[model samples]
Structure formats: C-alpha cells, structure tokens
Target chain A: MADQKDGNDRKTTVLEDLKGLKEVVKVKTQEQVEELKKPQETQLYRSIFRIKHDEEPRNRALSTLNNLFFHIHPAKVNRDATRYGYTWGLGGITFYLFIVLVFTGVMLMFYYHPTKVQAFRDILYLENDVPFGRLLRNMHRWAAHLMVMAVWLHMFRVFMSGSYKRPREFNWCVGVLLMVLTLLLSFTGYLLPDDQLGFWAVTVGTNMARATPLLGHQGPFGPQLGMTPYNDVRFALLGGSIVDANALLRAYIWHCIAIPLIASVFMGVHFWRVRKDGGISGPSPVMLESEAKN
Target chain B: MFGDWHQLWVIISTPDNIPIVAMLGLVPFFTWFAFHNMLANDRLIAQLEADPQLARTHHRTTYPYNSRWERELHTNPFLMRKELLAAIIITIILMVWALTLNAPLEEPANASVTMNPAKAPWYFLGLQEMLEYFDPWIAGVLVPTLIIIGLMAIPYIDANPLGNGYYTYHQRRHAVWTFLIGFEAIWLVLVCIGTFIRGPGFMWYWPTQTWDPDRVEFNVNRNLDQILGINGSWISHILPTAWRPEAAIIARALWGIIPMVVYGVLAALFIHWICKRSAYSRKIYSKMSIIQTVTMYIFLITMLFVPVTIFLRLVFRIKYIWETPWFSI
Candidate 1:
C-alpha cells in the first residue's frame, strides 16, 4: 500500500512538472485549439468525425448507438448473448448469404437478360465468353442454396432454444415469413438459367401450387369453383398457360426485386424487435437452482 | 338448376367482401381497446400511489426472476469478434466450393421431350416420393401445408414451458423426438430414396445398377379389387339391379378398409382407457382439451399409419381402401 502511494505521488509530481513545461513551451496546446475553432463552437467535439476519445465506460456504452451499422445492437446486452457455443451464428450466415447472392446476382445481370431467346445464350456467354462470369454465377447459385439451408437451420436453432415466447412471438412470425421468402427467392431464381433441371423443377413446383386446395384450379374444389385454364392461379403466375417468355420475365422480376424488398422489410423488423426485446433470448443466472431442477 | 336469386346474392356478396368487411370493422375497435388499456393502467398506478395497503394487497406477490444471466456482461466486443471470424471462415469455404464445383446446367428444356423420371428440386423430393403412395391432394398439397403450419404452431401449442432458453432434450423428449422421427427420419429419408434409389420410369434401382437409358421396368398397380377376387359377391345379387355392379366393387374395397377401421377403434379405446387410469396418464389425459386430445391422437396415428401403409403396399400389394377418378386416398 505504501509503495503504491509513493508511485502515485511520483506520478502526480511528474504531472505537475509537465504543467510547468506546458507553460514554458506553450506550444498552442489550448490557445491554438480555441483560435482554430469558431467562438460560437465548443472546444471539444469540434471535429467532423467523432474524433474525441471519451472515457472507456462512456465510450463503450455509446459505441453501438453512435455508429450507423451497429445501431441494430442494443445499448445493453446479456453475457449469454456473447457465448459462441449457444447459437452457431446460422442466422448471421443466412444474412451473409443474402448479401452474397445480391452482389453476385447484380454482377451476373450485367451480362444477362430475362427472355427465353437470350437466357440460354447469355448463360453460355457467361461460361465461355465473359471473364469470371462462371465464378459469379457459381457463387450466386451456391450461396442461394446455402441461404435456404442456413435459414432452415436458423429456424431450428431458434425453435430448439425456445426463444419464441410471449413478446418474441411476433418476431418469430416475422422469422417464418423471412424463411418462406428465402425459399421463394430461391424458387424464383431457379428458372432464370432456363436449363432442363431448372425448367422441370419449376414446372413440378408450380404444378404443386396448382393443387393448393381451394385456391388452385387443378386442386381440390377447384372445378367446383369454376376454375379454368385462363383464370387459374398458375396462369396468373406464368402470365400464360405455359412457361414461356412471360414466365421468364416474371421469375426474373420476382427474384431480382419483389422478394428481396419484402424480405428486407421483415429483416428490419426482426432485427429491431430483437434489440427491443432485450437482445436475444437467454437464461439469466438469477433463476433458482430448485426452479431449474424442474 | 339452382341459379336462384338468394344463391346468386350469397355468391356475389360473401366471396371476397368478408375479409375487407372484417378489417374495416375491427380497426377502430382495436384502436380504442389500446387506448383504453393504457389509460386504465395509468389510473391504476395513480390509485396505488394514493393507497399503499390496497396496492400491496392487489400486487399479492413479487415477480419471479427466471433469467440466468447477469446484465453487466452483455456487451458485444466478444460476439462481434466471433461473428467476424465465422463470416471469414464461411467466405473461405464458399470461395473454395465455388471454384471446385460448377452449377448444374442440363440440356436446354424441351417440353415435348420430358426428361425420364423428371423430378422436382431436392427440397420437394420427399413430397414427390409420397405421391407414389398417396393422392396428389394429400401428398403434394395437404402434407406440406400441415408440416409447415405445425412447425410454426409448435411453440404456441406445446404444454411444457420448462425448456425455454436452453437445450434440454431430456425435459422436452416428446417434442424433440416427434420432430426428429416424423420429419428427419421419414421425410428426409424418403428424399434420399427419391434422389438416389429411384431411376428411369420411377423404378427402384440398386446402387450397383447403373441407370441405363434403355432400362425397361413396368409398374403395374394391384388394387384390392384384383387381390380379393373381382368375382361377383352375394351382396350384388341381393341389391337392386342398378346398384348390383357397384355393390360388388364396394365389397372388394371393404377388404382394404377393415384394417384401418380396426386400428382407429383400438386407438380410441386405448385413449379412453388412459383417461380412466389412476396415474400421470389420467392426469394429463383428463386435462387435455378436446382439440388437444384429438390432435395428439391424430399425430400419433399418422406417424404409425405411414409405415404401416408402406408395409402393406410392399408386402401385400394392397393399393387403396377407397378409389375415385381424381384420387385413390
């Protein structure tokens, strides 16, 4: 204790000596800063970017809120949320795959068009003609597939963790919406290549949609509802009775724009609600061991 | 014949307007209800402040602290680091995979020349496989819808509240095992079969056998009519002449329906027995609502039914208990 006090006294004495040196040098330490700033402006916080370094606690407290990208995070969070073993960050990877898809998709669009006539040729050109077009297409295709897997696994994680309780119910619904949207996005993108596998896969898929009980024509109660080829749900989707140029254009528009827009709206709500609902569901140490035993 | 005025009125009025009508009517009610609750809460708080004894009596007890973490340790520096590491690892893996494999691009589509045994994508392969056994209405439409809705509704319908915020398979064994067996074992296994085991004309292929284009296999379905002797029955003779032919066909179909009816009857009796027992079974069974009880039995029966039906189909070559032009469910 005595040695620590002696060290502190020495530190204070050195600081006092620096004060004298500061006066002698008077090297624009305070006066220059004041002169540089407008009289109406304050001395601190005078920089364009928040360049001022505050105390550690205050700085850390405001770090999330002060930044644009980090605002999704709560100002306060539980230690349980930081534990890497609890959740495998599947949800984050799903979002990352979405980002990867968009980036590669936009680049691929530069070399392609959504028409039956040009779609196949565009793919060939991408593979044999354009530089790294194959890589771009591959990345997009693999990432879209990965996103579906990630979203499903994310839902599994959330369900197993039992995180969708009470106040979190609404967010859970949003998450399910996002999952369906993810699948829809992948489904719509499946036909853009216009290959046999893509074509038949979509044909089988939309054919299933045509059996949607009451809503679809070829489905149960469809004939009773007076559904015909021209008026059925599948026709509305394909924009014709068959998968033609119109179908290609419809898939492209949905994959590129509509689904992404809806997914973004749900994602924004999901993140904000997660923050508002105290940042990820986790067990707190406050529970009694007896209660835990049950 | 029934294009009457009232029927036309009901068709024109009720088909599309119900949803819009409901929404328009409920908006103001919900708005008012929100405000009413807020003001009521405020008034209650003021009243509590004015009288301590009544407030104490009304509150009755302290709120339970169920959380298991401390607040001071919830910062994100460690989490952010971990997230960054995961992203970097994933990016490397994705880059490696993209370089290693090319996306599948089969020959340009020809609608006239449909690919042999054309299949849906991997995710829907399980549903497609089921279409071999059941009607399109059930396998393709109803099953997928039920599975999706059931998954979403589980957290709401589950009776146990002990498994939240932790991984406790021991505590939630019933829930976990049901999901794993029903979805992973049955559905995903079917998907694997659909992907690898099936070949041209949807014929089962051994792994040793190469799927040759020239392979010829016939899938002749043997229904109850064929199995039970489509010879005219005694009931056909007793029935009126107009119904005689149809009655014989119905008697043949009844052979397939016998097992299903017996199974349902036995299950119902077993549940009734449980409700009368003097143990945990009785407690849980009696407490279950009608919907809950029915759902439990339905879930168990369906899980058992799939394997049994598949067994009968493969072993006995029984096709359908009931058949129609549109379905054979």
Candidate 2:
C-alpha cells in the first residue's frame, strides 16, 4: 500500500511538470505578440528609420528631412504648389522617367555587346530567347522618347509660369545644358541596336556633324582650315571616318558611361539651385504691373 | 482616296513614329491646359486689381485656400503622396506602351543599302528640316547653338517682374506669345513636317500621298542673285582690271548682305515698336538695360529669320539670299 501511494505521487509530479511547460510557452508567445504590437520600438526599425513615424507635425517633417532620397525636397511647401494646374508635375515626371531609364538601361547593358559583329546578333537574341528581353528594349526606347517629350513639356511649363526668372536664371541655363545633354544621350543610344534604322539615322546625324563650321571637313572654311574626313570633328565623334565598329564602341561608351555621369552632375546642380533659389518659384502672390519696383 | 488614306495609316502606324503621333494629341492638350489656367489667373488678377480691398485681403492663387488651413503643408505625405500617385500612373502607362508596341529594328544595319528617306531621330527632325532652307553649318550647328543660347538668355533678357511665380497672359503677353511661336509654330511644326511630309528622297509629300521613290520634282530652284539677273560683268565695268575676276563674287555677296541688312533693321524696328506699344510694355522696356535690349534684338531677328527663309524657299523658290564661295545664308 505504501509503494502504491509513492507511485501516485510520481504521476502527479510529471503532470505538474507538463502544465508548467504549457504555461511557459503561452507566456512567451504573449510576450512576442506584445513586442510586435509596437514594431516602431524595435531596434531594427529604429536603426533604419531613426524617427518614429507618427501623426505628429514634427514627425511628418522629419520623415522628409531624414530620408536621403526625400531630402532633395523641402520639408514644407506652399499649399498651392501641390496643385497640378500650376506645375503640371512635368519636372517630377521627367526625373522619374530618368530613374526608370537608368534602371532598365542597366538591365539592357547586361545582354548587349557593343561590337558590330555581336551587337546586331545580341539584340536579335535578346528579343527572341531571353525572357522579357523585348519588353526591356521596348521600355528603354519608349522611355527615352517619353523622356525627351517630358523635358520639352517641363521647359514649357517653366516658361509659361515664368519660373526661370530672377535668381533662377543660372538654373535655367543649367537646365538648358541638361536639355542638350538629354538630347545627346538619346542620340548616342540610337546607334546601339546596330540595325538599319539606327545605322542610317546615326549616319545622317553624324553626316551633319561633318558640316559643323570650322570643325567639319565639308563645312564652310573647313577645308581652308585643313580639316579632312580623317581629322574633322565627325571623325572624333565616330572614332573613325565612318560609323564602323569603332563608332559603335564609342557610342556605347558615351551613351552608357560618359554623358550620364556629366548629366548627373548637371542635374545635381540644377536641383540644388532650385532649392537655393527659394524652393519652387512658387504659386505665390502674383505681382501686379503697378507694383513693379523698377 | 482609300488608297491615300491607307498610305497615311502606314506612316502613322509605324512603331517608331508612334511618339510623334502621340505628340499630336499631347502638345495641343497641354497647350490648351496651360492657357486655360493662365486665363483663369489673369481674370483673378484683373478682379483683384479692380478692388483694392479685395486685393489686400484675397488669397492670390486660383486654388481654394481657407484661412484656417495651414498655408504650408509638409512635403512628406501631402506632396509626396501625389508624387507617388503620379509615378504609379506613369509606370502603368509605360508598361502598357511597352507591351503593346514593339520597338523598330529594321533589317540589320546594311551600309551598302541606304534608307530612301533616311532621317534623324524625331526630336532632331526640326534641325534636319532646317537643312532644306539653310546650309548644314547654319541649320545643324549654328542654329542649334543659337537656340540653346537664346533659351538660356530668356530669364536675363526679360525685365518684366510682374509674372514671376504664377501664369498670366495679360501681364506677360509678349514673352508668352514669343515662346508659343518659337516652340509651337516653328519647332513642333517642323518636326511634324519632317516626320509626315517628307518621303522617299526626303521630298515633300502630302499626308496621304504615296511615297514613290521614283517621283521627281521639276521645279527649278534659283538663288536671289540669279533670279534678279545680277552678275559680275556690270560690277566689273566699275572696278579696275585687276579686280575684275572677283567682281561677280563681290556682287553676289553684296546682294545677299544688302537685303539681310535691310531685313535685320526692319525686324529690329518692328520688335522695338511692339515692345513700346502698350503702357505696361513700355514700362517693361524702359526697365530693360541696353545690353538686354541688344541681346533681345539679336535673338528675335534670328528667330524671325527661320520663317522668312522658309517663305523664300517655298514661295519664291529662292535657295540662298546671300551666296559666297565659302558660306551662304
């Protein structure tokens, strides 16, 4: 009878151990739920975001100010500036298209070869065999065309709103240079496909460079200046007398590396000047002719 | 008529030509949209100007502004949200465009075989079209340089401070109109012509006309000196025997220069007249420095030269107004 009682005691001890394990698991799970409830308090989230995202006015401003990408924008803007009618969002759209171009352009570069023998065949292979290759090429080409149109429209909007006036004058000049760079970028990319359309188009384009005054072989006084097909500006442009293999390679370098770097530098100056010129030239109070200082 | 329509369809439907086709709709719509907002702002300005009390108290923008609401909004959610939406919309449009249309890849670049209507990309078409009226140096190099300089010079040259931030046609009529003429009447129109009108041989064809490679135009084009029957023989009589050989060249050069000089003077005077037309415009002109005035005249006359040369080419069939051994205008 004493042995049976001891066995009963052992059974109760095991049951109590199992119950304690269940309680521990439940309490741990609850603690985790509590921790997840305020994810902003987590070290990982804190380290990355740095600021708590909240409905407070300070946080709202901090959100823009603290972020590297968003910091290009001023924390506060004229309420009227948000209206589509004033700015038409053209400038922003152009910048976004550029970003899109860079992304897709990088992807395209992975598959393309700059040499004459390989360039055409690469394009064909990209279109036929590689998944989403056609879409990638189409996006790059169309986005390029879109970017040109956007640049024009942005200029138009700025002109219409007279945003180019005053302290913004130098910025406008920078913008003009950027516009030229944009066109050059598009033009260089035109020859990359190495197809008949691109080849002929680039041929005609460089042909005009042959007529650049003082620098071109066929231009006015060019021959007098001792310019020739071998040494004129066009030769320098194409890396040779004609749009051959070297021309293809030169175009690739310009389109991919050189111009983009230069353009990015100019773009940095353009945006910086915009801020220094007192944010966007405003949807501010219209000054009357009678109120003119001069 | 059906056949002609089909030819136009082919041109318009070409994958590469799609951007120019899209431009037809986009340019006009945006232009109208700009004018519409500009007109509204002008009306508001007029209203506020008439009422001194209202002018003092009124919010200047066309957008609704409640005094109780914040004058400035945080860029994070307020502006960034709209920007995000715009980016999304643009992405959708781009995706659709990429899926629907295939980028053109004309049979691998053959150097031996040339495209009958070989053309520059659509954006440079304006410059290419200018080649028809001017020398390549002028059209391709000088003009593009001038355009860039002229555009950059605008802010400095414009003296009127009335329309700085907002859109208003009344206060800045001259600036607005000049930009419209330059961008719309000249640049955009020339691009359209280059894309739609020029066919095989880069010859002018109506929108519906077939691109016949063999078609030839018989009209004889002449220079201004040729048409006027001016020659070196007459000038040689007035010169010494030693200068006789160069008389024809000098005469042709003079003929070209004289008219251009007259045109330049006339155009300058016209611009001056316009600038001084209204009380407000005169006020604006008076504010401009001498340097600004001269720079303005240079760009204005050059801009006017484009249309004048086109007129001479198309209507009078005159090739070069000023012809020399080296260069011709």
Candidate 3:
C-alpha cells in the first residue's frame, strides 16, 4: 500500500510539471500567431530569415540548374589529372575560349552592323571611336585566334589519345565538321573589315574556289577554262560575275549570325554525346607508340 | 489525317520559332517515359530501404562516396589559394591585353581595286602557301576534304586495346614519330620558303642580263599589246601572257626542286634517326612523338624572316647584299 501511494504521488508531480511547461509553450505559440497576424511583423521576420539564408537558397538553385542543364556532363570531373601540360585538357581550354567568344561577341553586337555599307564603318568606329572599343575589338580578334588554336590542339589531343576509336566515330566526324566550321567562321570574319587586306584575301581565296574539281574549271581531268559548259564555281560563289559587295554581305551574315548559330547547335550535341558516350577515356597504348616514335 | 489542337499550343509557346516548337512537343512524351524509369529506380531504392537485412547488406557498398572533394570554392585551402590566384592573374592579363590593342582596321573595302601583295590572314597563310604549290583544286577542296574525313575515320580505324596508357607507346615508336616530325619539319620549311622569296627578277638576284632599262620598256610594250588585244601572235592572241623581261630558267627550276629535296631529306633523316633511338621505341606514338617540338620556335622565327627578306628584296631590287640568297618555292 505504501509503495503504490509513493508511485502515484511521483506520477502526479511529473504531470503537473509537464502541464506548466505546456502552458509556457502555448503562450509562446500564441505570441507567434499574434505576430503572424501582424503582416509587417511577419514580413520583417521573413526578410531577416531570407537575409540570413540567402546564399543557401542560391546554392540550391545553382545545384538545380546543374541537374537540369543538358549540355554539361553530370559526372564529377577528375581533380588530379595534371600529367599533361595543362590542368584542364585542350578541350577545356577550347570551351573556355568559346565562352570568351560568346561574351565578347554579345558586347560587340551592340555596335556592329551587318549591312555592307555600315559594316566597314562600324568596325572602324569600334576601333577608333568607342571607348574601350579598340580593346573589345582586339580581345575579339585575339580570342578568335586563340579559339582556333585551342580547337586544333584539342583535335590533336583527341587524336593522340585515341579518343576517336570505335563507338565514337560518328562523334569524331561531327568534331571534324565543327573544326571546318571554325575555320569557315574565321574566314568569313576576315572579310568583315572590308579593307585592302580583306578584299584581296577574298579574291585570292575565291580564285582557289574556281579550281575546285567538278565545281571549278581548274580540274585535273575535266572541262578547261573556256570549255562548252562554263562551269565557273567561283562565279556562282560571288553570286554574279565577280566577288563584289554582295559577297561581302553574304560573308558577313554567315560569319556573325549563321555559323555561330550552327556551331552552337552542334556544340550542344557534342557535349551531350560526350556524356552519353562515357566521359573521356584515358590515354591508350597507341598514343604511347606514337609518342615513342616522336 | 485530323490535326491536333495541342500542336498549336506548342507552336505558340516555343520561343525559338517553328522547329523548336516541334522539338518542345517531345517534352511531354519523353517526360512520361522518363517518369516510369524514375519510379522504377525509386521503387528499387525503397525496397532496399524497407528490408532491414537488405539495407544492412547494401548500405556499405551502395553509397558511392563516403568522402568527396568539396565542390564549393575556397573549401580546400591549397586548391583555393592556387586556382583562385591563377584564374585571377590570367583573366586580368587577358583583359588588359585586349583593352590596350586596337584591332586592325583597313581602308573602306572596294571590290574593284586589286591590291598588290594581297595576303591572307596570318592563320590562313599556311593554306594560301599550299595553294601555290599544289593545284588549287587539290589544295582548297580535295586536301581539306580528305583531312576532315581522315580525322573522322580515326576512331574507327585505330582500335588498339592499349587504352590504359601503359602498353600502347611501348610498341611502335618508329612509324609514329617518323610521321609527326617529318610532317611538321616539311610544312615548316615549305611555309618559310614560300614567304621569303619574291618574284625572280634580274635586279634582285643572279642577273641574266645587266639592268637594261630599254629591255624592260620593250617587255612592257609587249605586255600592253597582249592586254590591249593588238598582238596577233598565237601565244599572245590565245591567252594573256605577261612577258618576262629577263628571268633565268635555271633559277626557276631550282626554286621548284629545293623545297621538295629539302623536305624529302628531312623526312628521311628523321625516320633514320628515330629508328636508331631504341630506348623510347613504342608502337603507339603520342601526338608529340618526337623531341622536334622544341624546333617549332626556330621554324616560326625562320618564317618571320622569310616575309622580311621578301619585303627587303622588293624594295631594294638593285641591292644584292640585301637580297635573300634563297629562291622562291
């Protein structure tokens, strides 16, 4: 009887303590409800929380973007692969150059005019008139040069690594197309300045176009220059008798707009395919043989 | 076939116009397909988690990374210091360089005037030089096409299993280095020689005849007659042929032979040398298969000299000492 009574008293004391604690919590929650009722108080608290946790939310958004974006391969890149000359391989550098081109090209578009009459003047204005215009142009020019070089290096890197082997043959062909497009982009851009250098360069370049087999007259075993069918491929390229203003306009459009848009499309596909094909393979033995011979 | 009204929604909603609209229409169909696969994976994970015994067995091996490299910047002390510093420095340098130099701007473009010394952009100069040697058909179209096709075909053709890097180069060093070094050396020489040598004229180099003003005038008259269509001679009448006042046949012949001979000898010597270097002999050659990569700077310097020599020869035709001893390729 004594033990039972002691247990009951102990239980009663514990319950009373719990009740007191519950009352305090109830009051606190009531106070929170009152604050929420006041819109300003709610907003202040929300703002304070946001200020404190802004970066966390931003990081989450960034991660989400990474998850969603299709171009990037989802794999964690190798952090310690510096056996080659650079930390990131040649492909990474080329990608970096592409980024630069995109950024600078956007800035340049503000001032650039695609028309034949204004194209030359706009280029001149960028060089001589605009503040930091010269630098922008220079950067654009140098970046273009570097982009080509990096791309070539990337191709060589892929070639030497034997990355193009087996299942990647189609992708390799796409890459080759990308390389040609890069050169074509550079060539068309060269004509944009419309200077003596640009004009003559186009002339000489187009002259070579005239020599194309089945297309041009300078074929090894085909129609001569003044034959029955005057299949002058060069004439067609110029859109008339010779390389005139029309050719310049065409080159400009292809350079500034068409080629870039096409390259971007292919680039997206290229990057996605790389992910699908399994992230880049390590160097193979064939590369080693090539190295040894060198 | 009945038209679907939903296609109109796709066409309107797509920001990139009609083609993008068609592609965007795939999203819902793909979403449904992907959702099924995702549910399957979820179910698998849930099943593994629900059974305590299975969870216990799988937990140890299933989790890919217990510890991973922190992706956030400034997380790793060493990496933060090195990468951040390097990126800053390089970006600044590039930006500054871009800012200072005004890009080249030439005179207003006119298609009418044929500018003398019409040079291709520096990067295209290699191909331009090649055009002079081979038929333009070969140089411009056939060669470029071949190069592209060859590159694409590489992956399929070279299917050796030594991809792990340990075994490939250990076998075939001779063929690889021979191809690489020989190719580079030859291209470098050809490009260099093409740049330096100007038009073979009497006043510039070995004179076939003493500087005769009267002979030049006579040739000029003949050239004008050919241009004006006054000349009835078959050679002049048939096609436009600019009269060479006094150019040496031997000099012209030498010009053609020297580049070929030089390239041939270099290629042969490189093959022979690499054959003897037994220590590094490997079957799969690397991109830089030989040490001749160090020689590229020399080649670049020589290429610069070629253009300079050509310019000097053109300006000072009478000055023999200034004239390059090398003939035009």
- As for DockQ, the candidate ahead, 2 or 3, is 2
Candidate 2 residue B245 C-alpha distance from true site, Å: 2.9
Residue lDDT tens for model 1, B1-329: 22244533442243122222332343334334323433443454446556767665553112222345344442446466777888898799788767977777878876777777677665567788887777666787787766666666665555455445655443354565566567556765676667656666776765445555677766566776566566447668777889786885556555546656787777667646644554433444555677776776766566656666666776876777555444465
Candidate 2 chain A weakest ten by summed lDDT? A1-10
Per-residue alpha-carbon lDDT of candidate 2 for residues A1-294, written as tens digits (9 for 90 to 100): 323324564545667667567666777789889999999988899999999998899999999999999999999998889888789898899899999999999999999999988999999998999899999999999999999999999999999999998979999999999999999999999999999899999998899899998899999889889999999999999999989999999999999999999999999999999999999988978777668888
Q: Scoring each candidate complex against the real one, what DockQ results?
A: 0.21, 0.75, 0.19
- Provide candidate 3's TM-score on chain A: 0.68
Write down the DockQ of candidate 1: 0.21
Model 1: lDDT of residue A224: 86
- Top candidate on DockQ is 2
Model 3 error, position B20 (Å): 41
Q: Decide which is better by TM-score, 1 or 3.
A: 1
Candidate 3 structure quality by residue, lDDT tens digits, B252-307: 33343544455446655564455446643322223332433333323323333333
> With candidate 3 superimposed using the best TM-score fit, by how many Å does residue B124's alpha carbon deviate from the native?
2.0
lDDT of 1 by residue, A1-294 (tens): 323324554545667667567454564556667666654244454442352345466666566667677667665665555655456578888888888888999999999899888898899999888999888888888777677667766776676666775557778878988887987898788888888877887787777667767667878788789877667888888888777788899999999999999999999999889878767876422221123321
- Model 1, docking class: incorrect
